[model samples]
Target: MAAIVWQTPANPPEPEDYIFFKGKRYVRPYYFEFISHVKNRWAGKTIVDLFTEEFRGRPYEYYESAVKSGRIQVDDKIVSVSYIVRSTQKISHFVHRHEPPVLAGNVSILHSEPDVITVCKPASIPVHPCGQYRKNTIVGILQAEHGVAPLFPIHRLDRLVSGLLIFARNAGKAEQFRQQVTRPYCYYKSDDVI
Candidate 1:
């Protein structure tokens, strides 16, 4: 197994992560490369069909246009949309991503330890990548701001909820924490209920 590396914030958040305007937070549009490998189940399927079936984020016409424009590639080379995929073949999709604006709240670190880190998650930002949010999330902000990577969230908070969140530094710690939290009588209390 590979050794896990723990990172902490060493610099400020990246300028490209967001733009603060009129008290609103908006993430700047950026390009992202979505890379994947063909699985055994996908073998013999057309590239366009595979994309259309597996990824519903874009329309079939968009995938066709991307394939033709070389925005989508197979094994580092552009291929036709009708090209048949083979097992273990590499596929790349380069897309321009735009995340929606979120609340101009900060994700503040509350505590840190060798195996765990705690933070005060702000509202309007998802804990991780979901739906249309990829970069405008707590994980993304922590990575861009603090340089922490490969984080394993022990629990999650809703996008509209603000509260303390815990993250494990490594997979083992995450699993251990999960086991503890999943035990019977391991309950949570909200401040509002107090």
Candidate 2:
């Protein structure tokens, strides 16, 4: 058997293993910034306008509360929703933190090789972090259980689907796998094609 170089930490942090967040909790803040490029493009635009443009799905009242709570800032200074923005300025926003739903299940490692690994992903586990899913994902499970790191998934299965999934251990292997899957294979020689 191959030697186990690393194992799950004896006392893994609560809710997850990775330390990508500050609080060591599953929930983390959402932060982003957009620098003004075109002059006067955002001259009359209010903070609410920019946030609404960025998050069209959210109701206007959501941003209203965010501005009131000082969660949104302009160049690090808390501003109201109606605060007008200027060109060449920086606008930043941080939303309230919330934890992603914890998926309860197991992931079976079907096969492993030097360059790739095959696993049977459980149902309801997302392939990657997005929206309310940060930890409690396939990648998180691999890190928390197995010692896999820097994993590159060659393909993805829906969050609700369970099936065999392949992951490349490195970038080179991932690129090679991508090329092989994307290009059509010709069994015959070039001369055989009419």
Candidate 3:
């Protein structure tokens, strides 16, 4: 596990806000994370249009600046407004959380029992083993940090989306959680509170 830490402003930021970190200490506020959040969530807009709308302080100058500065790269190349922003696509200027296979502090223990562990996973963390996020996911944190190895997540969450995630402490209970999760309302059927 690599040594990872976060630094933030004197005032805490709401979830979805961005802050720059220097080791375990916060350096300063970087930029507004709400730009991506707003652009990504809106419907029926072209990528360029979304970009222009989100970064409201400038005109063509801003887009030109982002392109010229090499701050925005897509598909390993500097992208123009023509690039389509699809689901799960990595945006330029996006701060990717790429902590190595270690216990990321992003997870919160929502519920824990002998059978399972439920967590309120932040938007930036991965849910399970995939891509560069395998061991930095919710299951990894539960097993490695919380002293529960062999943990399995009941469902998967997108890397940049916030939601509840469940991990199985044992195989049997894992399957039960799996069954309930697939049934939609089964989360309510079995756990009541989730």
Candidate 4:
């Protein structure tokens, strides 16, 4: 009869595992700028815009405190929750403190990126913070999930509605989107593109 031998493990501890509903598992090595893609892809938008289009369900309120703690990022750096995202930059999420970010209580993630995130917000979800929805809106869910850059709801969808709604990654892009929205489509092309 022959004797058997045993082996020992090498690595130490591993990171904690948690399930994310909206996080993009596909880490594509892509770059974007708030300028170039903003005008075309997600130009001129706010959290409310999406409500009208995707969640005409109802109205909601937003406070600075709730927005202040919201998470955001540009190039791996967690920035102002509401800071606008510039053109052609890498983006993602971080830990969010923005009052847990609200949701329509019913929605799903379609596509997400540094510059823009398309959501299928349901009609029951409010676009912004308000009522029991201070932490039940789509933005809230997103903020809670990754804690990236503060998000701006460019357009809205009805609470009961459903479709593609885009969100801005930072404040610069939010304001730029607002400005571009007021002007003609050919007015700006963004000085920054990566």
Candidate 5:
């Protein structure tokens, strides 16, 4: 039998990106630039109106304020709230992102192979970025901690569920694994059993 050697993740998480408070882990608020190109339907629409219709995440007043304060830009230049958008024009919206806290449990690596990496996912952490989470997710943590980027998960576990997760190191491996394992198996805690 070949001996299994354990190796540490190549990349470590940045200290400034996280905060620990009262036994919970939170991603520090940071400025994020959201970039997008004007769509055909958005052409001729005022910047404020376009934001209000497409991005309901923030209220109309917030978008208007952002435009006035230069937090929103068109083609890297500040524009008035009433500026009409044109097709192919680049838009950038800089906003401070705040992510909710999750449990302090760790994501433990179980196995690492040439084309696959497996980990024991902790509860309260999502498989990927969704909703109110970005850097606090399993994929984000692995990328920051293990230097693993562009990982493809074979299956996903809910944010509140804790279980083993398999990740493909590359896109080709991910596709191969998906074809081989037609029905991925998941282990749930007894409390979740019906």
Candidate 6:
């Protein structure tokens, strides 16, 4: 005879947001979670099928848009609406909670060319939205404060560190930087050992 292992659902994130700028500690809301009890429940089923048939209530269109916007994740990784599940897996839905921090000082835009834009990002401002950060990110700041939109970031810097960052205005401009720019830069801290 085989033994069965009991399992419990994941604890939902609290109403208050948790964040860690440098270390790996952050908490974000989980709108909902679904753990397949049966191994074959998701076999040969599309991502939308599981949401519509199993977790039905709202229209299928809702789930479709949610998946498209990266609100759905299969086994901790965001997946598309057309993704297929082969076996029992955990699905998590994340909801964006708009609780961004406010910074009084203005971010400096070093340069703004037709193809790219360079800005001096402040410390504690995230380059993009993730975990507990949303409207407080560099991209968000540019839109709300400087009125720059549809900017594609070429590279990223740590949220806890302030430095110059570059962003490409379009995909073609991004490719140009990737092909033409080839310079080696070193980042080292003198503590004790290399």
Candidate 1 local lDDT, 54-170, one digit each (tens): 999789998899999998999999998889999999998877777789988888989988889999998889998887787788988888878777689999999999999999989
TM value for model 5: 0.80
- Model 3: clashing residue pairs? 7-25, 7-26, 8-26, 143-148
**Structural similarity to truth (TM-score) of each candidate:** 0.83, 0.66, 0.41, 0.38, 0.80, 0.47
lDDT of 3 by residue, 49-146 (tens): 66677767557666656655655554445666565565545454533344343322456788888787788887666776554443455655555456
6 in model 6: Cα distance from truth in Å?
37
Per-residue CA lDDT of candidate 4, range 51-169, in tens?
Answer: 23433444333222322343223464544434554445543322222222222233566787777777777655566655433335566555555553467888777654666677888
Report the backbone clash tally of model 6: 0
Clashes of each: 1, 0, 4, 65, 0, 0
lDDT of each: 0.84, 0.68, 0.55, 0.45, 0.85, 0.67
Candidate 3: misplaced stretches above 4 Å?
1-105, 183-194
Residue 33 C-alpha lDDT in model 5:
68
Local lDDT at 46 for model 5: 99
Q: What is the C-alpha RMSD of each candidate to the true structure, in Å?
A: 8.3, 9.6, 12.1, 19.4, 11.0, 15.2
Judge candidate 5 at residue 141 and give its lDDT.
84
**Residue 146 shift from truth in candidate 6, angstroms:** 1.9
Quote the positional error of residue 81 for candidate 4 in Å.
Answer: 37
Alpha carbon lDDT at 83, candidate 6: 89
Model 4 lDDT, full chain set = 0.45
Error of 2 at 61 (Å): 1.6
Which has the higher lDDT value, candidate number 4 or candidate number 6?
Answer: 6
Best by lDDT: 5
